[model samples]
Target: MRIYELGDGTPEVSVVGAIHGDEPCGERAIERFVDEEPTVERPVKLIVANEEALDAGRRFIDEDLNRAFPGDPDADTHEGRLAHALSREIRGTTVLSLHSTQSYAEPFALVDEVDAVTRSICPHLPIEYLVETGRFSEGRLIEHAHTVEVECGLQGSEEAAANAYWILRAFLSATGVLPAPVAGDTEPPLSLRRRDADEVVVFRLLDQIPKGPAEEYRVFVDNFQRVAPGDRVAAADGEAFSADTEFYPVLLSANGYDDVFGYAADRVGTLA
Candidate 1:
């Protein structure tokens, strides 16, 4: 992990990037922002995690770092040891961990569940959706207190990098590390386009959309769109499966994961 800090005193605000080496958007955003040398109202720690994997140009050297949180210092895997150190770096801080996804080309936020910190920060983000990982939060960084994770956009895309930078700026502004955004602010017009009525639709992950072994796979529905009962969800080797009940697809993508296409989520409510 590589860490950089702006301002003085121990930082209570932190930003982490590049946990998955395959996702360069986060790292790109951090470097771009740091290049500006913007003045900050409070200290903020910015980190580039999984540097080894990044250097290797692989998703991980041993295992997924996001799934190895609060890891053991004595653990065997490279990620396990790195997780332990990374966890310590952001502990007790209001954190934004950046990421990009293949499932969606739009930014969205995720947390273990809605809480005071979430309610306070998420609404200010340039996103239309907020996901509650709930029971699926096992070993994820968001399980740590005061952490918000964002899926910036399609992995490896320049748009994702651009989105990540603005999202970081918005998050820092919301947390008071930077001046609040205002009319005629330096931020581009896209950053000001908050969701409908300034509300973020909330979704709770219910179950994984299982995928069986097949030569090829395909997904039919769009992420965040509701799937009606009996709607065709996906196909494996031309074998199709239909939904038994209504659900909103979250992170649904063909070939995104080996064992699953994505996740089935329910629209719980909206956070204003």
Candidate 2:
């Protein structure tokens, strides 16, 4: 991991990037932040994780790092060891873990639960949605107290990099690492100025649409849109698959993952 420290006290905030090697947007954002060299009000740590995998240009060296949280230092897999180290790196800090998704082109926040930290900072993010991963939080970094994970945008896209950079800036300001933008400050990309800092559309993950053993598959629903019973969601080979119940698709994609189509979620009302 590459660590960048700004300011002189004990760091209370941390932003982690490149948990998955294929998602380089976050790392780019971190580099951009380093270039700007903003003088922070409080100490902050910016980390670029999974360097080996990143060098290899693959998702992981042995396993998905995001799913190996609180990992074992003596474990066999590279990700397992890395996870343990990362967990230690951000412990007790308000962490913002950056990620880029293949499913959606829009940014969104993800949390293990909605708590005081989430309620305060999530609203400041450049996003319109927040997803709570209950049962799915098992080994995720967000399961740790005060950690927020963001899906910046479509993986490897220029827009994703821009979103990640601005989102991290907003997070720093919200957590007091950097002074909040004042009235005379120049407008940033995707300005949060016009947004209600108290509002966010929330969703709770219900289940994932597994790819099963299909050789060829295609998703037909727009992400964040509702799908009801009998609604065709995908096609595998020559057979069409329809939903059995009503739910909204969060990360809906045709070939986003090797084992899943994306997530099915339920709207849980807005946070204001």
Measured by TM-score, the strongest candidate is: 1
Local accuracy of candidate 2 as per-residue lDDT tens digits, 1-272: 99999999889899999999999988999999999978889999999999998889899999999899999999999999999999998987999999998888888999998999999998888788899998999878898899999999889889899889888999999999988889988655653332555689899999988887777888888888889999999987858889999999988787887888889999998777
Q: What lDDT score goes with residue 75 in model 2?
A: 92
lDDT of 1 by residue, 90-196 (tens): 98899999999999988999999899999999999989999999999998889889999999999999889999999999999999999998897776446435648
Q: Which candidate is the best by lDDT?
A: 1
- Give each model a TM-score: 0.98, 0.95
Cα RMSDs, all models? 1.2, 1.7
Which pairs clash in the backbone of model 1?
none
The true-versus-predicted C-alpha distance at residue 181 of model 2, in Å, is 1.3
For model 1, the stretches where C-alpha displacement exceeds 4 angstroms are: 189-192, 195-197
